[model samples]
Target chain A: MEIYNYMGYELIEKIRSKEITIQEVIQQTYERIEETEELLHSFVYLSKERALKRAKNLDAQLKNGKTTGKVLGLPIGVKDLICIKDSPTTCGSKILEEYRPPYNATVIDYLIEREGAISVGRTNMDEFAMGSSTENSSYGPTYNPWDLERVPGGSSGGSSSCVASGQTPISLGSDTGGSIRCPAAYCGIVGIKPTYGRVSRYGLVSYANSLDQIGPLGRCVYDVALILEIIAGYDPLDSTTVDIGVDEYTKELNRSIEKKTLGIPKEFFGEGLQKDVKEKVKKSINKLEGLGANVVDLSFPHLEYTIPTYYLIAMSEASSNLERYDGLRYGKMSDDLKGDVYEVFSRTRGERFGSEVRRRIILGTYTLSAGYYDMFYIKALKVRTLIKKDFQNAFEQCDAIVCPTMPTTAFKIGELVDDPLQMYLMDVLTCPVNLAGLPGLSIPCDYDNKGLPIGFQIIGNYFDEKTILNIGYQLEQELNIYRKIPPLTIRGN
Target chain B: MSKKEELSKETIEHISKLALLDLTEEEKEKLSKQLGDILNYFKKLDDLDTTNVKPTTHPIDGLKNVFREDIPGESLSNEEATKNAQHKKDGYFKAPRILKE
Candidate 1:
């Protein structure tokens, strides 16, 4: 019954072979959630009735010799941002606390219909996907399953923590900047931020339109690859999705990384990067070199400019995108609607939205406001072009780029929650990838001396997720970190 | 780094208004300092010379004006669309008064 620790693919095969019924997996999933949710607090809403119904249906269909679909009989924890039909999809904000989405996100449609994935629940996240740690959530921070005192890097912290703690075998998360990768690194799991136009973003609550992407997170490269292949591809519903074909990611995962060139960005190893993270990442590079991949030193000259460039661009878009949230439709409303529309809008947002959400919106409005737009927003945009060019040059000399997914391991839960500037700075390593709209994967490389996980980031050229995935898949065979489970799960069970 | 980035209290007031958020005195006071520091941090972008470099609005190239056949598609029903509304009347998302009395 402790099948929670099994890989997603293994669970699917076990169900397919009749070694275990789908009911057993579903029962175990809820049981795991029930056991640890008090401390982990990873899930915001548990979809018990609906998930059980789907599990029973899938079990019946299996008995009838009609298979569901590459399926996971196990649960997949969906981030609160992605809409699920009639499901409470609050992006960890109280503003939309009362609202339930009427339709499923395209990824949800694909996940349920194409892959037979069950939703254990909607995972927790930073409110409006604004913070680096999951502490900004209205429901409360999702404690790091590895170290309860520490954070699970967010805004996908809940998704990452759930997988790490064995509450779910896999989870889906959206990354605008470092939401997915940071948590993956912190919680010792695998996560991908696919190219911007690679996956459908429809029904995902937009934080920043241009920067946001929905991706998969799991305990291993294979779990992530399997989920990515299922959710990827063009859908007419999401025009931002590319018409290009998605690779056979799970099939293409086992290819050798021999002769592949990896670029190590010199800027990534510079100041403020923790000593432990640097050493662990450097050791990972040597492992890759020993595995037949070539490692080359490179520099992204405009790298430091990325923080400002990313924030300026992201905040401006967030301000514009969030304009639709007025009291009248889809969320908690003000009691007094007698005031003018502006009063109503302002009061609702002020009362409902959390502090971090307010700060982003306020700063976002300032950057886009008169007299400042050219100096801040426009300048940031042009610098975005230069950052893109930097990656373009690096990719020419190397097949992929590797760096520490985060500058440091997961800090204590309350460590960086205050000091907004400090929290924003934590995203320096990951946001630059979003600026270029490239595919980036974070795999557990090595552990710091503190017994915390360190994530190794493999960033790929646009639309080239397969190479990075293959590299991660191959690297794990040598390091063998995926099979390791966090002690927290064992203790909790 | 030539000059410190600072947000004037009045400017923060104006921004809060533009963003349409009613603010507490504490929020304005806190944001005035926090945002100024962030804007100061953002000043790092000025060091780069982006002369003639086109801004990347969206990362992918040749990804605009996606043309599909003009046709009616399955759209959300009125009830479904109004389902999440805080205030709805007659299958419509009812809103607060736009004009002051």
Candidate 2:
């Protein structure tokens, strides 16, 4: 039987039934990783010994009849930005080439301790999760599993690619302005960006702290829901995390989406969206309506300003959050400094961070600088208040907002490399959700004539993750469109 | 386009210096051009009716500060602190000799 076709629940049941061993599953996972990793470049770091040891322990526990969690023995891929104990948390940058954390992130702890999930490896990402494309990684860009010449959408590109390719059934990814969903969309998988504070950010290397959130990516909606259950919760280490009660996400999967309302915001489908993406998303919306969802035309007038507002606020937060990576503290040190403390600091930073990171830092610093503060940073904050208010108004009228996850599908790796602004604009549709701190999900809606998968985005009110996933599940049953398999380049079988 | 926000090489150097990044002359020139282009684009917003539009800082609901207990908590020991340091001496990192003659 193709056990990989099953959801987290069935996969766990098979392990318990003696039909499969965690060791066998993990070996399959590693074999797949080894097969596809060269083309996908999904991983920044892989721990063969650690993963095998964990698998062996899980197998022993199963043999002893000690199954204790939902994701028993499932192998998961982790984005590099989230720290895993003793693993190199490079954040896709060369500066932290040797930096290893003394502790696991709260999510890592949750996945390993509370839930018995084995980690396959750390996935590659954009440097500091700054860019929309995985091409910005200092290690090298991870290619889309669907097409080797194309990018796996980023900065969670690696996570999405690994999941899509079946290297792992599920993976953890962080979303700040479409990092998770965009890549998931491009790679033809399900990706969710939970409401801000829904998942603890304690051990996540900060990108845009306030907007950044940790979520999951999978080939299907059920797996996405199960993984979210494992990782979502409050952590005392992170004050930003809310102390919310965890829900049985898998149970919500069975909830019917008969009478739920889905709002299709007009502004999102405006110009600049590729025609192929529009058709796929529109057809999916119509299908959901056919399946009993009350599809309504909605207006989020401020949607056009989402990208600019997101950039200002995100860059500002990124500027401050990344300030701690001075060579004197962590990361690579510079040897060319000949004078004072200032020289040491400058030389170290210049040599360490990539051009993209430095550009953002400079832009952020300038915006927050003495004279520009009131005009830029403070102004952007006020706009953020308005953006959040827009979501609030929309949620009052509907249960969820549906849109395209990205303006277009994944492009050639070098297509937008020289034009950062164009790359930044690719995150237009999804950034607003991060700005509003709302829950959002991206699911494969259809494959275009060219055979590339297009994703439809569904967003919900704060803490309304269940509604979005239910809608996604219902739509999945109707469309039965899950074509984002890792191409032969990355699939071991 | 008016070049009001044009960044000079010296200014780029100054920003780089402030940012603690070492840049070769070639990189500085390239970054200067790129930064100039980006700033020029954002300059369009300066022409908008943003006088009434508030700048967005964060996208979350409410703004209440949550504070931790004042009780003392576990701290990292010096051994643990210096365990990963590439350079250290006498419980401190040793830098270049810096006594002015």
Two-chain DockQ for each candidate model: 0.81, 0.49
Report the number of the highest-TM-score candidate. 1
Query: What tens digits encode model 2's per-residue C-alpha lDDT throughout A204-323?
Result: 999888899999998889888888887888778888777879788778877877888888779999999999899878988898888887877878877766666788778878777877
Per prediction, the TM-score for chain B is 0.87, 0.79
| Model 1: DockQ vs. true structure | 0.81
lDDT of every predicted structure (CA atoms): 0.89, 0.81
Instruction: Report clash pairs, candidate 1.
Output: none
lDDT of 2 by residue, B1-101 (tens): 34467778988777665556668898778878877777666554444355576555445546457887799988877766665566678877656445553
Output the worst ten-in-a-row residue range by lDDT, candidate 1 chain A: A484-493
Considering just the first chain, candidate 1 attains a TM-score of: 0.98
lDDT per residue as tens, model 1, A244-280:
9999988887888899999998999999999999998
